[model samples]
Target: MRSRIVVGVSPSLAGLQALRYAVKVARERGGTVDAVRVWLFRPLWRDTTATFERRVHLAEAELLIPHAFDAAMGGPPTGVKIEPVVLEGLTVQSLVEHAGDDADLLVVGGDRRGSHLLGSGPVTRYSVRHARCPIVVVPPPALAQRQPVDALLRELDREIR
Candidate 1:
């Protein structure tokens, strides 16, 4: 059976890279891609839990969903059907909840900028640790560049072939 890949998209490099790579893998397997965009906004408490704040925050989040969808799926890989889902909550928490059932694989992008020098910390740990399905961590496009050793090895392998 073809794999069903689930990817979480945030407004960051890590999330966007994952979406692109997920589309690529899904095409290879004749699979489907579910791109989830999470809008997390909690009203500040200090008597600011007012009705206006709640409504406006939620509205802002909802509006972002479509824009995020377009950004994530605009040039998706061919033969891979992409579906978008927008969820509101803690990004990691929502993704964990999504893992309860469905989807054979979970794909997420690695943060390109740091908690220590590079990449997102909370996101990486949360995904690799808690996801029920196998998680694929895709690094940024910059990481896609071929290393010298890797290029040499590929050349050798081609000669053997």
Candidate 2:
């Protein structure tokens, strides 16, 4: 059976790293990746203008998924299938809810700017506690870049073959 991986992404470098990691895992495991981005629309009142603003935010979030994917992987990988999902809700709750029973894995980016604690970000911490499936928290760019490029290339080659 094919694996299903869910990745939570945003515009940040860490978010890019998470998406990249998800793509790599999907390629290696012969799985499909669901790249999900969540946005919250908080309006002062329930008016037409507020509704329009919510729509705008949803559109921007939808666009951000592909933009982040392209920026991270130089366009999606050739073999792996990636489905972009834009959800309206809280970040952690949305991700956890989306990871439902079908997902084999959930991938998310850690907040490097936050305190130096494991799963420091609320989303990461909450996901660790709430996600039903296994969760992979990708380190921020600075930490991830420290790994040698040759190792990553070798892994990529292995996956392709």
Candidate 3:
């Protein structure tokens, strides 16, 4: 059986980096990549529209797979097999459950921008602490630049505008 490498997928820069790195690992290991997107229903009114909300989120998740793949690698890897999975639940729980204990690896993006800690985002931190398989956190390339404080502050100011 081919080794299973599961990766969390999102549209963010870190998310795309994770997806790209997952594909690289999969190719080297001759494994299939499971690009998983977890969606949740945050209903405003309550459970009355829960079903409809789930469907909408599910559809959005399904569409995200291709878009993420495209943004990450210009398109999915040609030789490696890509399995897109969309699940309904908490992001961390859903990813861990899907990855399972037997998975060869679980890859997640390292997002620390809004995180209280400078290490990893909640998903990455949670997966590292909870996942049965080994976890790989791909840091965003922007962090390598190490922009000066003034430049970073200016960028943040622009974003707020």
lDDT per residue (tens digit) for residues 15-48 in model 2: 8988999999999999999999999988989989
lDDT of 3 by residue, 1-161 (tens): 89899999989888998899999999999999999999887776757478777788789999999999988888878999999998988998899989989999999988735333446677887898899999888877686437768989999999999
After superposition on all C-alphas, the RMSD of every candidate to the true structure, in Å, is 9.3, 9.8, 4.6
Write one digit per residue (lDDT tens) for candidate 1, span 73-143.
66445677867676778877887677545778888777555223234567677877788888887776665
Candidate 1 lDDT for residue 70: 64
Instruction: Give the candidate order by descending lDDT.
Output: 2, 3, 1
Q: Alpha-carbon error at 25 in model 1, in Å?
A: 1.2
Model 1 / residue 126 / CA error / Å: 1.0
Per-candidate clashes, comma-separated? 1, 0, 0
- Measured with C-alpha atoms, the lDDT of residue 151 in candidate 3 is 89
Q: Can you list the residue pairs that collide in candidate 2?
A: none
